[model samples]
Target: MTNPTLALTLGDVAGIGPEITAKALLAHPELREIARPVVIGDADAMRRGMRATGFDTDALVVIEDPREARNDPDTVELVQTGPSLADVPIGELSAAAGDGAYRFVVEACSLVRAGRADAIVTAPLNKAAMHAGGHDFAGHTELLAHEFGVKDYSLVLSAGDLYVFHLTTHVSLRRAIEDVTVERTTQVLNLAHGLARALGRPEERIAVAGLNPHAGENRLFGDEDADVLTPAIEAARERGIPVDGPIPADALFPAAMRRGRWNLLVACYHDQGHAPFKSVYGDDGVNITVGLPAVRVSVDHGTAFDIAGTGQANEASMVLSCVRAAELAPGWGAVVDALS
Candidate 1:
């Protein structure tokens, strides 16, 4: 009975991905107590990260196979996955960096699918760089969905007691509004509930945000929030989901996040949730994908290319993301399996 292993994938090599991944494992020794962590990225790039970030390269032990990874707090296990990114420059986008980042994700997912790893905590990958590399996906979620063969999934941003689930992400605002439906709303609520339960919080207070100004103001501003979102919340409450509102988008976040009125808030679209969440939580925000059987968590920010090699990048998000993934991974499979 071994502890579940976590495949920690490095994001964009040319960015701050390698540095943050290294710092997360090094700074947080508690991570070793929960799971066997193995770095899934380019070895050369990691060595460069250590040099740039003033980390002890000797502490990063390169292993030829994932099975060789150990739960040793003193050393970080490295299992190289992608092609060499030696030519890729820091603080800039490169097609080679994109390809490496994409490869690390695919390899990490493969490890989980093969049962070699139990969960994955990914660093940020540059979307434009990956597209230039010919991966041709919008973001990590799309690629994960394609690899895992899942159609129903949601992205959750969590920090402290506040949690937000996006009804639509990585899409245009026009398309995002159209994508919101009764089915998607109900599905995301269940997923958010499952995530809270997996973290041992079963009370699961749920809040639904309005799509219009002040929740349509009784259809004065718009009707979609009342016509579309209200029905979904009503149905959920009838099913005993502990749900409430079509609250005003502006007021809902303040009440839920700052006032502690709710545990989860379902946003109508991307920026509506992300803007406030990131503003308040800053570098502490963590993105958790709830529909997959395996726990998947990631830093809420993107590749900070401008500060990539300056050692100025904050690894707080990375540290929190890994900590949450390890805490949730043990029972995540069972929770998701039961939901399925």
Candidate 2:
């Protein structure tokens, strides 16, 4: 089979997205062997990135279609999506940069849906800038979910052997508590199972972290664990998904990371998963959107405006994101069908 073609969206041009993207390709030339990466953004912005990262100036080639990409190690294939963002101020938020980033994703979604691209590997986009540009979405996860017309999706943080799925993301703490219904929990469980199957581990163990401390400590703290979560776990088990939990958040993550008790984990909310994962994994982690039609992986870090143009942004996460996307692209169809 041919290598999967990936739409590599260079996110907020005003931030470190472009720099890291250029640097990832430059630093990891072997990425071309596994996937054909087509940059979906303004050509000038990518040129700026190549220059900022001291990349090969003569290597960038703008193609009219994704199929035209050569996946050459020395040549960076680009599919310009919108008007020039060459002059967008680095290290500062620009509505143009935000809109440009949004457009790049939209174009990528179009390509994926049309079967022109097999997956999407994204760099970070500034949410504030995207909102300022009038996109008014929560972030990349919500935006891509909307573009794909899917309501049952979760923001998943993945490193080697460990995957953390969030039940609620980009919401207030109170809202997060309110959103963790049994139905949503079950859906996320299935999504996690689907991810396991996609990764060739149909019997992979899954675990859920409690919403309250000590897993509500037998209802001394809160009833969400016993009342809301237990039923969902039971339902997942009945469906033949090997799962466990409503374990205390404090213990679940530590055991999962240190002892390898479980490979797939479901966190009740954003910080529950993000804080610990980011602390432990850092640039080694990549963000994934579960329940999309095609695989979408992103750098776990954010748009670093403080070091936007410094050429110091580490591309480790970006490189890993691309590699993960490529790895998942082959089996992603089975995942989507299972979710459906």
Question: How well does each candidate superpose onto the true structure, as a TM-score?
Answer: 0.94, 0.96
lDDT of 1 by residue, 1-340 (tens): 3566888898899889888877778877887776788999988888888777788888889887678886678777888885678789998978898898889888989989988888898989999999999999889888887788887788889887677998999999999889888888888877777666766776778889999899999999988887788888888778767777889988999888778888788998989999989888888889987787678889999998988987777888988887787777877866686457
Model 1 has an lDDT value of 0.84
Clashes of each: 0, 0
- Reference-based lDDT, each prediction: 0.84, 0.91
After superposing candidate 2 on the true structure, give the runs of residues whose Cα lies further than 4 Å from its correct spot: none
- Predict model 2's lDDT versus the native: 0.91
For residue 60, what is the lDDT in candidate 2?
Answer: 87
What residue pairs are clashing in model 1? Answer: none
In candidate 1, which residue ranges exceed 4 Å CA deviation? 196-203
Model 1 reaches what TM-score against the true structure? 0.94
